[model samples]
Target: MTLTPTKLSKSEKTRQAILEAAQTLFYEKGYDGASVRQIAEAVPIDPAMIMRYFGSKEGLFSAAALVDLRLPDLGSIPRDLAGKGLVRHFLMLWEGDRSGIGLPILLRSAVSNQNVADKIHEVFEEQVVPAISGLVPEGEEDSCAGLIVSQLFGLALCRYILRLSPVAEMTEQEIVERIGAVIQFHLDAARDTAGSNRP
Candidate 1:
């Protein structure tokens, strides 16, 4: 007897099916409301398959949360114009995927879940903060980072997630310009402090 050629290996097929089902369920019902069995039912797979492949619901979520994280290189941003560069990049990042469910799930989970909180923190600590640190420096990095992060998250939550009028409807450039100065000030303060500390 000859073995028939298959499009995908059993494991690959299973994992793809699980990810598709989970993505749909997660978008429809949200991360918290979605359950392993619901995903299994959607994929018509055994519930144990979720754990077998992903280890846990949290692991599945982390896998699902993976995104391009599109950001311009911080070092390439001109030293004198880092603020404007950052603002442009930030707006593009959010606007490119306004309909994406990742940010909503992240924001909501950050409020109530430790694992999600860790994910949020890790994204900032590793990807975002490090980028900003290179732009600024070690001493005043946290001040500038925290300030910018707070404003960015607040804007994201209020405009994108909460759907606040007028504010949300503003053009991306308008929003960026409005917020850019504040972030610039924060960064400028960092630069000044770092300069002073250099002995």
Candidate 2:
């Protein structure tokens, strides 16, 4: 509770340890499967300490689910290449970081837990929608955003979770090339539909 540098540093370390342990458990066992006792065991900390830091399992999960997609600024990307850029960025995030626990934890837990699913939806709706809203036709942002989310997450689920054959074996570049085109088409179609609908 004190603001001393040493105390603050130690507190932060314990907090991070709890989060890392919780993420691993959540990734391997899902929300319902991963319990506070298991997380505490993984961290080698007391369950009470975890409660002291995060309050409850839901609170801990909320903290652990935090992830920044670091989506590229669409305005800076070439208009034609936006889809390629977006897809490539996600591919990099997925394949490039074996040590990353954020996205995988969220993806894995979301399958069985309504809370995690809702959190995932909230994250994309808040972050992805605003990022590409300007590029989409007025009033079509939500639908367009949903389309983009489906393609990207679908690719992830097939390749990462389900480990389907061609998708699992394909190189990142192959994924970027194939999926990027589809994403681009969706973007273009959204804009086209908006234009046609305008008075």
Best by TM-score: 2
**Model 2 lDDT, full chain set:** 0.85
83-184 per-residue lDDT for model 1 (tens digits): 667777766666665334455567666676777777887777776777788778777777788888898888877787677997799888887777777778
Instruction: Give the residue spans of candidate 2 off by over 4 A.
Output: 1-8, 98-100
User: Which residue pairs clash within candidate 1?
Assistant: none
RMSD of 1: 5.3
C-alpha lDDT of all candidate models, in order: 0.75, 0.85
Give each prediction's root-mean-square deviation over alpha carbons: 5.3, 3.5
lDDT of 2 at 198: 66
Residue 57 Cα positional deviation in candidate 1, in Å, after optimal superposition: 0.8
Candidate 1 minimal-lDDT segment of 10 residues: 1-10
Q: What residue pairs clash in candidate 2, if any at all?
A: none
